[model samples]
Every structure is written in structure tokens, then in C-alpha cells.
Target: MRTYVVGSGVTKVDRHYERNYLSLINEAVNKALADSGLDISDIEYLVVSSAFTDSILNQVDPSTYIAQNLGFRKTRALTVSSGEVSGAVALDYAHALIRSGKARKVLVVGFEKMSEYPSWIINRVYSKILEHEIEGIKNVSPPEYAAMIMQEYVRRYGVSREDIVKWSIKMHENAVKNPYAQLQFNISLDLLNRALRISEPITMLDSHPIGDGAAALLVTDESITKKMNGALIEVVDIESSVNLPIYLRDDITYFSSTAAAYKKISSKNEIRLDKTVAVNVYDTYDIYGLLIIEALEICGRGEALKCLDEMPYLNIGGGLKARGHPVGATPLYQVHELRELMSGSSWVKYDGEISLAHSMSGPDNNAWLILLRRWV
Candidate 1:
């Protein structure tokens, strides 16, 4: 059995002050269903991915709540929460169900609502995603970790800070054309230099913004593809791995989990990195984006900045830096954007058959790599 993504949809990545969780989910799911020309009744399973429903929304069993609200009377619903990688985890579940002969059609919805709370409260919740008892209590946040990694990368690689700033400028420029992106305006190196410092060597401009958003993907077996006229993007392979916490790791600049997952996928699939036209990486911070490129072996270690200009296909959707990292919903957005780009429906034009999406939890404590091929 083979799994194919028949359709996908995403809501604008922004502070949805007027929309609630159910409303956002409904909008994304409905758009996906409409794109596939399949009704909600056609879906056999519902996989919901979220990270803060319990802590922020005070809602328990959010999958059940979403099922009940969405009129999924017979469809089995499951929830997946793996910090920031929840979306990719949920997608893995959906793929398994179809490939294992359990279901013909599966709907994966990833969402996060974070703008309703204050920055202090949101920051506290974000810290909980780390090794809570250890790193959480130390007052070290994600930005600080990113700063440590960035500083070390510069020291060891001899990459200039100006080169890193170019990544942000490129992302913002790409986002300017992406209607769903949160930060859709162009940025300048001078402006970034003047931006407020979040940590040493990391300014607010380099970090992804917190916002509310949702994305949905409809995964179905090959049998269902015959009946649908929409573009089909095959789920070539999905691989994931876990590593020790950043504190336990020997190198702060390397992402072992991401490397492990990439290696697994490479062994199973004959994917050519040079031929892959688009790659969506977990760019919660600029340094993480650069690190992912090296970890995936797209470029040699510490060579990302040097090879940055050579890799023009990276983060065409603006990445999390400008597209907005709504935590659990982010991976789904990557998948959705790749689907659009591969199908030639996106603002950015790329004529390629393969695309890769990368997502991670914390500073690469856990990471997932999804390979997608455009079906001709």
C-alpha cells in the first residue's frame, strides 16, 4: 500500500484574535476537503496535533473535542503531542494507518493557539517543552539555546554574523509573496542590527514569532487517488529519531537527532539532494535553520553559510522565521507549502518532483524528516 497526499490547506499565520480553535480547525480542514473534492464523511480517521491545548486552553482530550465538534461520528480520532514536532508525528500516524491497511483516507490537522496569553506566560509554557526538571528550572529559553549554538557556530566555522543575517533577509523577502505568512515584509541587515536583542548575538529579528494558525493535509491510499482529480504528492518516506538533551550532547552546534533521521531516510530512499527543488526546515531560529542544512548533509558541516547562496530552494515559503511557527501546526504548513510549490500553484515557481520537510522538538531533541514526491 502507498500513501499519497491528495490535498492540503492552511490558514494565515497570524494572531487570530477573532477566531477560536474550532473555527481555525474547521477553516483549514474544510479547505482541504474542498480541494480534494471529498466531504468530511469521506475521511476515515482524524489525527489532531497540538502542544498547548491542555496547558493553555484548559481542554482535555482535544482530539475527542475536535471530533465531536466536527461531526466525526464514526471516524476514529487520535491526538499527538511531541512539543514542536507534533505535526510531523501526527502525519507519521496518518501515513501508518493508510500503509497498514487500516484506513483508506486519513485527515491530519495541526494547530496551535498562542496569542491569547501574555508573553511571560507564553514563554513559561515554551520552556516546559525542554527537559522540564533540568533545563526548564534553569531559566534558559529556546532563544538562549539558539544563541549559544549560533555563537559556537560562528567561532568554529568562521561564519560572519552578516552571513547569518542574510538568511533572515531572504526569508522575509520570500514571505512577502506568501499570503499565509505572518511576517510578509522585507527586512534589512541594518534593521536587524538595530533590533532588540533577545540574547547575546541573537536579536528578535532572528527568532520566529508566536502566533495562532492551523494547517491540514489529506492523506489517502493509491486506490483513492484514482477517483480524485487533484494533484497527488506521494509520501515517499518519513523518518524520525531522538537524541539526548542539548545539555547532555557533546557538541552544541550539531543536531544529532536531525542527522540520524536524515541518514535513515537516505538509506531507504534514492533521493538526490541536488534535484530536490524545495526544502522546508525547522527555522524557529536562524541558527537552527543553518544547522538543519548541515545536519541533513545538504551542505558539509559548518559550510551552510558559505553554501547559502548556492542553495536557492531552501525555505521558499519564508520558513518559520517569517511564516510563523505555530508550534504543532508548523510541519503541516511545510507539507502544505511543498505540495503547492510542487504542483506549480504557489507564488514561488519551482519545477521539481521531490521536496523535503524537516521538523524538530526543542533544540533537536527529537526530529522528523518527511520526503514527498510529486506524482505525475
Candidate 2:
């Protein structure tokens, strides 16, 4: 499919959801329309993404409700729930529909209001995303599972606790400059050094906080992009991996789904991931980020450190740790952030090449990758 991102937008990611879930989505959708210089009527299709909103915020079928609120009563809209990967999945669906000639312009919006519930209740909601047999009955929190993976990753990669803390410090430092970031605290290495330790090596600083936010993207056909003089950013390739039960997996160090999806994208497209100008990887936790980096084969088995020194593009937009991971909105925010960097609106500069965004889930635990470029 020849899908190009015409425009994108995001509301400041924070817990200030004085508005309802649908209202948040409409605000973001309107922003995307304004950014693209298009009206709400211009969107032929719309996809909505959220995970805990319906359960915690009491807003089920947000797509229909949001579309009506945005004056998209006549347009087709569907809700997508895929844990944290819902945003990426929604993008994939829009791209496919456009490429298949089923739609012309699609509006994709992702949102979540996690602050609606208390922290402990929110933790319970996330735990439901895990397999019941392996994690549900055990009442293993998401951070607990992540901590288990962190233990394995540390053993395999020889990554020290200090290395992860350094990453957190850098992320928060970057977040201070991002006005939209929820955790704008400019933390130093020393603070992260002593930040409350949650699970052995995994500390409270290492995990993404429960924030509220919304993000939107306008994807159009290649022809429509030129006709509208759209700020073209090509969706070069999109791939998704199947869900895997954590306990059934062969190795925690290697995410089979991520590896498979990366391989598929590599074989089908001319994506030079290593040379990409910028990258946004799913980073709900430091360990998860490390796992994805390794699984994508961006570096050698135990060479994340070496890769880090070479690749500064990894999560420069502050990632989930710094940018505030608002669940469903995280990936969409990544796409928007990458678009800004590619369009030279960001502080960083590149040769006008490719940028990538990766998103994952915890329940089905699906993982997805979206590769983009300024020019094909």
C-alpha cells in the first residue's frame, strides 16, 4: 500500500483529563486535521485505540462516540484494543486499507486516561493483560514480570544496574525540554541512582508512570499527498508479531515476535535500520527497551552498550520513561515525534532518511514496527 503521513498531532501527555475519553480524542483529532489543513469531513476512515479507558474511565465504544463528537457521523470508524500495541495496530490497519484502495485518507487516533483510577487499581488493570495461568493467579504486576525479564536480560547482556539508571537520567533530562512530556523533572544521575528500587535491579525510576494523553495521525494515499501538498513522510513498511505467552517462550532475552517481525520487514523492504536518522522503541520499562533493542538485532546478543554508544537516535523523544507512557497513546506519540524530527522541526538533524517506531502489548503481548522515510 502507498500510504504517506500527511499530518499528525498530539495533546500534551499528562493526567489532566478534565475532559472525558471521547473529548480527549476529539481534541487530538481536531489538532491532526488542523496540522494537515484538512477538515474532519476529509477523513474517509478513522481508527481509535485505547486499552484501560473503557474499564477504568467508563467509556466503551469510544470510536463511535468520538466520531460523532468530531462531526464524523458519516465516516467509518472502528475501535482497536491490542494492549499497548493498539496504536501501531491501528496505523497498520489504516495503511492497509489505503494501500488496498479501500480508502483514500484515514485518521488514526490513540488515547488513554490512566489517571482515572488509583495507582493500585491501575496496576490491577494492567495485570489483566497477562496470561491468567502464568501471571494472573500469581497476581504478578506488570513491573514484576518486567523485573523477571530484567533479571534474565542482565545475566545475558551483562548490563549493570548503573547502566539502566544512566538511561533513565538521560531520558528525564531530555523530557525537561519537551513541553508535552508529563514527567518534566530534570533528574540527575545521582537521583536515579537512589530512586526507589521496585524489584531488585528494576527501580521505580525505570518504569513508565501512569499518565493520560492523546495523539493522532493523518495517513493519505500517495496521490492525495501530492495533490494536497502534504508534508510527505512515507510509511515504508509495517510488520506485527504474534502474541506469545511469557512462560511458554524459549528465552526471555529474545522476544520471538520482535525477531520475526523485524526479519519480515528486512526481507521485504530496503530499510537500513542501523542507518536510520532516528528511532522510537517501546520503552514502558528500561528492561523492555533493552529487550526490544536486542530482539530487533539492532546490536549483537550482548552488545546493547556498544550499540548505545553508536546509535544516539534511540528514544530521543524521551520515550515512555521520560515522555510519559500513556499506554495506547505512546506509539502514536512516537510516530508524531519521529515525524517532527524527520521534518526538521526537532532539534536533531539527519540526511532526510528513514525513522522507525516500535510498539508492543503486554496481554497478547503483540509487538509491531512502523518504518518511515521522507522519500522513497
Candidate 3:
């Protein structure tokens, strides 16, 4: 019965074509209630994270049309569509409505617009979030079922092609210092040999574009963070796993909800995943960001492409492959790119307290993992 994340916000993940979806959910929900100094009447509950739609904005219960266009009278709006981890299922339903006493303040939002259609109509609405009557309605999508499980994990783990283009060139050099990244340029390896393959071994530069924005968080509990302070992050542990659908998984090549968020974040954080300093999963396809570093066992099986030149803060927010996979607002921009890369300076090349954010939905039935730390 605990949770904290005082405040968060994000918006620039491109293709917003001058804002829509209720002004990108009222500019990332009023900059996450103005970064949680708070006062949208101290938000009660709103937890949206629904996605994919845009026939001139068909508002099919978009969290009660963004809580009746933000007037929010008497709060309590919900949505949480579990695909693309509908923003980590609306931040695990606002951390279970503030640990179940039933709200002390919760506002997690996660909208998406997908450039208002036509990329063959949002890739057929991202193939209706898979399991399309037995895997992609018989035409196959989700980048041809993740390019046939990344061409059988690069032919049963012999993986190469410079270890599969080194995680799209290290997530575009971590999205070039991530200004709310939506593909913040930077890519080479000979321009990925003229990419644009689309589904051979997946490319167009390893996918994750056509993104629209909105990400937010407010979460509360430590008695509303002792009457609100600046930068705090807690969410000690949160785990979720639901699999067995891609033609009933037995072993459809890993992703039992990323091995159940790596066995529930290593049994509720005894500490592992190479003593996490940084690692945001759900790479929005660079072959599941190299099978989520061997499904979060942190490397072993197929040795996650030679442990990506020794994992120095992998993903570092350039995850969701250069931070644009705005599906269900991308798990609230993975807690707004790991709370803006672990709130302010701590230089010295490592240890930003602790961090890990994972999210998924459908195909990997529905997965979630979040474990931040840093409060001191």
C-alpha cells in the first residue's frame, strides 16, 4: 500500500500536426498539474491511457472525453485499454487507486493520435493489437509478427549483422539527448544500408514512428508526498503479467510478458538486472529491443547481442526506439523518460538511484514492470 511519483509530464513526441486529442490532453494534463506543485483541485482520479483513433477524432469514450474536456467535475475517469500497455495500463491503474484506500490523488494520462491516419490507416490500427483471430487475421502484421520473431531470433541465436544493428544504433544515440524524443535523428552504419525493408528483418530504421504525443503522471500516497515537494520518485515495485494468446503460447520465443517482468522485478527488488542503474524495456521493436535483453534475465540466452557493448545505461530513454512509440502514450513516456532521466544531476557515469520501466500489451498478452527508486 504505497506509491509516490509526485509529478511528471511530457509532450514532444512528434506528428502532433498542431495538437488534437483534446489538445493533447490539455497539454499533457496541464504539465502534470504544473509538475505536481498541485492544484487542479488536487486531482482525485483520472487514469486514462487509451489509444488509436482518428476519423476526425471519434471520441468513443476517450476517458469520458478527457474528463469532459478537462472540466473534470468530480473526477474519476478511467480508460486503460491494455494494448501497447495502454500506458502501463494507466500506470497500473494509478497504482491501484493509490494503494486501494481509493485515491489520495491519481492522474496518470496517456493519449495518442497517430498522425491522424493514413499509413494504410494507421497500419490497420496496428493490426488490431494482435491475436487477430489467430495471429494477424491471416495476413500478419505487428511488423509481420515482429518479423517472425526477429527471423527466429536471428536464426536460433547465432545473431549478427553487427548484432542486429546494435539496437538501432544505440537508440539513436539515446535519442540525441532526448528532448521528448520522437526520433531525434542520428543514425549511421552506412545509413543502415539504405533501410526501408519494412518486414524482412524489419526496418525503416527498426520502426517506431507515426507517433503523436501526451504523457503524464501525478501519483500519490506517502501522505501526498508530505504535502508536495519537488522531484520525488518511488513506486517501489509494480508488476503485472498476462500471456498465452499468440496461438496459445508454449514458447513463441520468449515474452511471457517479458518473462513476467523478469520474475516480478526480481522478487520485488532484492536487486538484480545487473544492479539496475538504467534499463527501460519495451523498445517498440528493435526485435523487442533485442528480446528485452534476454527477457530481462539481463543477458544469457543468445546473450542479448553480446550484451550491447556492455550495457551502459541501456535505453537511457531512447527506448521505445528513439522514444516515439506513442502507443497508448507509451507507458506514460516510460514515466516521462525515467522521470526526466532521474531528476537532476548526479554525474560520475552511473547510479541514478535505480530505474527500470517495462510495458507491453496484447501479443505479449499484457505486461508491466515499473520499479523506480530515488527519493533521497
* Model 3 CA deviation exceeding 4 Å by range: 1-4, 7-40, 43-50, 55-57, 60-64, 69-107, 111-123, 127-140, 159-216, 219-280, 283-289, 292-301, 305-326, 333-352, 358-372
Q: Which one wins on lDDT?
A: 1
Worst 10 residues of 3 by lDDT: 343-352
Candidate 1: residue 246 lDDT (0-100): 79
* Cα misplacement distance, residue 70 of candidate 3 (Å): 7.1
Candidate 3 per-residue C-alpha lDDT over 1-376 given as tens digits, one digit per residue, 9 for 90 to 100: 6888877777888887877877877888788888778877678888887666533266665888788877888888868776788787678778877888688888888877887867887887777787667666776677776777777777887776546777888888878777778888788777666888888778877777778888888888888788655567887777877877755666666886778767877876787776245778776778787776677788777778777878777777688778778788887777766776677632214547778888776446677888888776
lDDT of 1 by residue, 1-376 (tens): 9999998999999999899999999999999999888889888999999988889889866889999998998989989998999999999999999999999999999999999899889988987788877888888788888998898999999988768988888899889989999998999988976898889899988899989999999999999899866557999889999989877889999998999998889888976575145899998889898899889888888988776677767888899999998888999999999999888898867878789999998889889999999877
Instruction: Tell me how far candidate 2 lies from the true structure as C-alpha RMSD in angstroms.
Output: 2.0
Better of 1 and 2 by TM-score: 1
> What clash count does candidate 2 reach?
1
- Clash tally, candidates in order: 0, 1, 0
In the range 208-327, model 2's lDDT, one tens digit per residue, is 877888999999887677666534688888998885677777776677787788888878886556724477887788777767777787876766655665666778778899898888
- Scored against the true structure, residue 68 in model 2 reaches a CA lDDT of 76
Residue 20 lDDT, candidate 3, scale 0-100: 84
Worst 10 residues of 1 by lDDT: 270-279
Instruction: Assess each prediction's global lDDT (C-alpha) against the native.
Output: 0.89, 0.79, 0.76
Model 2 earns a TM-score of 0.94
Error of 1 at 14 (Å): 0.4
**Could you tell me which 10 consecutive residues in candidate 2 have the lowest summed lDDT?**
270-279
